[model samples]
Target: MRHSQADTILQDSMAKRRIKEVTDAVTHESPVKKHLENLLENKVELEQVLAQNSNIDQLVKAAGRVQPNPVETITTIDGIHPVVKKKSGIKKSQIVYDNDYIDVDYDTKNQPFRHVEQDDCKIPNFANTWNAIVDMRQSKKAPVDTMGAHCCADETQDRPTYEYQTLVACMLSSQTKDSVTAAAMDTLKQRGLTIENIAKMPEEELDSLINKVGFHKTKAKHIKQATDIVIEKYGGRVPNTVEELVKLPGVGPKMANLVTQLAFKRINGIAVDLHVHRVANRLGWVKTKSPEETRIKLEELIPKKLWAEVNHLLVGFGQTMCVAAGPGCSTCAANKWCPVGRAAVGK
Candidate 1:
């Protein structure tokens, strides 16, 4: 059918608008299409440069010049794309440049917008999570003192400011439940747990008092040796710094950092135990295999101001709701926003 000039112009305008809409959708929706557009633009720019240059050497140099935003060339087939760094062993789908063409070999399972383990993910809003868990567990008392052994040591007044007692409590609490450690401390209190008393107390007697805890016999021996060293070297004073605290028998980064924080009121670094390590990984805060590694990573990621609160908040959260075995996911306050909890509950 023959159309009038005005009608033909309107129809052409509509066709152009439709093409624009489709092009925009493809550019935004498909990674492959976007990559193609970039390649085409670069090709056109390269041709223009080559057409203007007469010298082959100059053209080669110009062609080799890097673009302002260089395209990430994927060279591995293990689902890792250079677009973003993934946590260890996480699978990803990405568009790769393959022999002058684009290919999409994504996992097809992971939603693009869904949160996963990526370096670009936001730092955890732990303050809000801490507040939520506090509200959740408010009715019930925290599984232990917020400060663990340090609490017991502080309560022992009228006994020559027993800083060594605080150190002993921290060392004793390792791998031992808070209640068990507290009970052992009570026994020590009754037996007059001072350097003078511990130095004189027979190893067998110390073992019997703390036997309820795990590895009590070995811990008892360590306590005796550590006590002797403290009395002999530091004149019966527990060292205030992490370097000196770690020198005590049975003390590690966890004990050293905790004692420095609670006993000495110095926050040298983050304290990572089994609970802290497990919870941090599950929350996608840090990917590490050991508590020591977790401590190091967390110190780098977490703000200095939040360092003191991480241990207490995570420990309490771990004990009350985010337990190692069969956590109370249904009643957990952070479950709604927690990625690990959501995945576990299949939401």
Candidate 2:
């Protein structure tokens, strides 16, 4: 009887399974020894079987206990086997906030993007760089505090009206630049912006005082609304926590965080603004789309101990060496490691 292709294919499959069964049964024996024994018993048959099925994938899969394929190791530029860790969403990349210090899990040998400078370029440590800049800038002159008007409330000669004035200043500073906000505060100081003054002050008169700032008219209304809430609800005391601070009119995370930072010396989160958002991303410390996202990213990477200092350091840097446009990157202290600064210098 002539055997068809199907019958021949079935015999070939049976032979492979029998080989797997035999190989699996002798688990205690060394693989090489068992193979040799099988070879000696049916040397001709085994040779034909080996030639027909050169690939061991089927046998390996059919075996009850299979030895897995080895994971190929990659060597880094330094010739070290880098410690690899898998973060859920992000691709393998390095975040060198400071040149002197680096925290990375994977080798940068195969990174998709190239740095402007060589890999071995000596970058200053993040902590040392910031501390030096802070000291240098602090010695030079302090940046105009956007909330200076609010803070002045605490320095009032009359302790009875201190909190009232400070809360008003905080509200006024929202959506206003420091210079404009400071000018607005000056007007308020000249004519008491106390809650009693604000609540009783005519809407037209209140808007006229802070008219120099952005959104003065709406702010005037919000000031009155916030003052009424403070007096009626919290007994005229500004709440220290973010939860309570946000309850005030037009006060979001930025205002809430700032108020507590200045008024109560409490910091629950980093207060991000246009400046903080720009400087953090330029420094290669955070990859965020918005100020709110930047605040969250900064909180994760920056140690809790440095939470109070971020707004100050970044804002100062933004105003000075890291200005929004025409920044003086050529003379920046972090120019060597700062991608933005280095590119500007190259330009």
Best by TM-score: 1
Give each prediction's root-mean-square deviation over alpha carbons.
25.9, 25.8
Which candidate leads the pack in lDDT? 1
Angstrom error of the Cα, residue 224, model 2: value is 0.9
- Candidate 2 per-residue C-alpha lDDT over 1-347 given as tens digits, one digit per residue, 9 for 90 to 100: 12343245335755656655656464432333234234324444345344544534543333334321112111101011123353222111321111121222212112221122222213335654565456555545334433444335646446446655656666777545667777777778788656677778888999999898766776888888888888898887767666666657657566667666666556677778777888878877777755666776776666555666667666766776677654677777666657777787873
Question: In model 2, which regions exceed 4 Å deviation?
Answer: 1-124, 145-151, 157-160
lDDT of 1 by residue, 1-347 (tens): 12243244234555335433433444222223222222222333223333454333443333333321212222111111123344333222433211111122221112111122233224666555555665665555565534376566744454334677878888788767898888888889888878889999999999999998766876899999998898899888777766566657677657877776666566777778878988888877788866766776787776555566667667767887788765776777777667787777776
For residue 339, give model 1's deviation from the true position in Å: 1.9
Instruction: Give, for candidate 2, the lowest lDDT window spanning 10 residues.
Output: 72-81
| Model 1 misplaced stretches (Cα beyond 4 Å) | 1-124, 154-160
User: Please, what is the TM-score per model?
Assistant: 0.62, 0.60
CA shift at 86, candidate 2, in angstroms? 28
Clash-forming residue pairs, model 2: none
